[model samples]
Target chain A: MSLQRLAIAACLLPGLVACVNSTVDQMVFNTPGAGIGDASVVILGRRHASDYETEPEFIRCVGNHISSRDKSIGVVGEQEFLDALYPWFEPRTAPLRPADLERLLEHRDVARAFTTMQTRYMIWIDGSTVRNDSAGSMTCGIGPGGAGCFGFGTWSNDANYEATIWDFSKRAEVGRISTTASGQSYMPAVVVPIPIIAPVQGTACDSIGDQLLEFLSAEY
Target chain B: MSGSMTIGPDRWLAATLLVFLLAGCGTKQVLVQSEFPPPVMNKLPLTIGVWYDEEFANHEFFDEAAGRAETSWLVNTGQAQVQLWDTLLKGMFRDVVYMNGKPGPGQMNPVVDAVLLPAVDELQYAIPAHTNVKVYEIWMRYRLQLVTTGGAPIADWTMPAYGKTPTAFMQSDEGAVRLAAIVALRDAGAHFASTFTSIPDVAQWLASLPRAGDAARRRVQP
Candidate 1:
């Protein structure tokens, strides 16, 4: 066989059943000082919108990724922060802007608890990943002899997210970061169905985490 | 004689019929329970008392959607309601006293500066029957009335709270509803703590209190 034919055949060996495409876009209005100290950060999902609510697991995924990458910085769980502050940080009462934070800190209890936490940055994430596009279907049947699935099925998911970073210590809006990720998954069956899944939301989380690390950290 | 006996069609028919007959439950009773954290806010420095009536104490909503085969849901918010309000009133006021009966011309009541009454006005729940995602949601409307110690009306306001399960995957219907109700209760606490002074009548009433002169100056604050 020709070299070109062999190369093409090699590419097709894995069936090319799964692929993911993702992008990260960030804007920095101000940078941090030298080196990140023992300050902590909270990655919270915004759920004020009436039509949709940010998935709680997605916020945890991003927090896990950020914390796992750097051991020096402390990452507070979304529920922990919300529960600690109680009604203050709940969806309906959360501060939407840096100025709101200033007002929120006017209260003695809110200011005392918030300032003592050493939370330097508040990252608000808003968005979700949805299976927007899909086509094809698989049919399965069970009989007295055997059961098998036949046909080719494929689907695609789109993920869009935005991160608004607030420097709580400074009471200022530092920057904004957004990510978009799309992935395609495919399933094919001769007698046995070979299913392939795409990591659509995971990709989005990775992009957001990387951008956040760069946006918030002074070193690494 | 043969050791094996032949089975008759009657037995097979009876067994098949038994397999198809399912003992399905017609109703689902969800006794909602949840914990509430103390809110962060400036306390209104007026001695207050709350009275929970029989209907408000055992609040339950029976939801039977129209023209669906779904099981009827009886979500009892009584326990959680008392717990939430008890905690919330404590966080918002300098002192809280739970009274046994309503204040009236003849009824015996506590010597509080004001009395707060909270009742569930309406509750609605929805579950995904045809939607792609399996999510359970609940919305609650509360009628809150503030009255003087003599049962004279100070301010009456309506507040709404909403909550939904993050995801229903791998969760039972009862568990999902429980979580949803908990979330809704928390949402109510948040709303009350943050927006109590935002209501015009409530703010006016708060400002009218002798100890709330400072509150009157900040009544217009967001």
Candidate 2:
């Protein structure tokens, strides 16, 4: 398919399959006069919470989306960055604020990494997708003659996430972007079950990715 | 119908078979290892001696809550711990020397400022069972002692670390445990790097050392 057809198909995919609605909000404290050039952006998923963790797939989804949209944007791989820094950026030890980043830069090796990676923007993403309000169920069993599932099922999923952008050169949070998305999925079984699954998390990731690309690459 | 039903030879045989299948019966040996990254810190201005005792070097734990013949998990952590601590200590100190025979300051082959000892005080692990949450968790506590050459204690630090799989949907039991252990080890390293100087005795010992050019960098003179 041509780029135009691909774009058209992407636009119409959700309408044909499932419904996903998402909203993006951004607050800019300080904007860089010059856009990000050679400097890299590291998007890390926050995994410190006791009960839940931000999925790694979601972080990669956001990174891939932004990089695909704009090739010039230097988006560092999450695991590579984490391993290079190792214990410093682990779940329990990561700096909670930009001031903490200042403290981390005090270390000689960490400072060297800042220069080596040319990391200018640090995006910390924290949130998770949750499923609730499931109202139906499908039952499957095997009898003497044949085996099949029969029932109707539905559930609601909500994906809410917030991304804090830290300008490493300035040692302060420049802005934050948050996305909220929710969708309902259904499954109906006469003999075989058909699922109309919603991609709420993907919708949220794309929403945040677009806003981030515009923030870092597009002329405002 | 009563929930408690009578059991006979056939039912007993069936229950035993079912339990064996569910538990993945017998012994499972697992090796827990991790690749430690170099800490980003200026080395302390001290040459420390590290002694890895025999038991500490070959430590492994066997977990058996279902009696001796049933489910048993044998996890070996000695080699990984030694490698991790060795790498970590190298990052934290200017020079490190291995000690032989647990020698005191009076007559040691390779003499240093102080001797360091690290041991696992306790370790515990859990896997998803009879629950909706598919999670694997591990917890470890470490005992670290910094002592003078004469064996007088300088600082005794005990710290805890924890790790768990984010989602254990399709991972095997052994794989999940190994991953969690790696996370816990990294957590311990992070804590040690960031919190070592905060110990009162260690702070005092560090204060005793003469100025090493820039105090912020903690760089020792050659």
Tens digits of lDDT, candidate 2, A101-182: 8777667787888799999999999998888899987899865477789999999989999999999988889999999999
> What is model 2's DockQ versus the real complex?
0.36
lDDT of 2 by residue, B1-222 (tens): 668868887677688779978666567777987778777677887788998888789878888757644468888889888888899889888899998757565655477878888888999987766234545778899999998777889899899988876563476878888888888888888888778877778877777756642362354211
Give the DockQ (2 decimals) of all models.
Answer: 0.52, 0.36
For candidate 1, lDDT tens digit of each residue in A96-204?
8888888877778777877677888899999987776678888898665788999998889888999998988888888899999998888887667776778889889
Docking quality tier of model 1: medium
TM-score of each: 0.85, 0.81
Q: Residue B34 lDDT in model 1? A: 79
Candidate 2 residue pairs in backbone clash: B105-B149, B105-B150
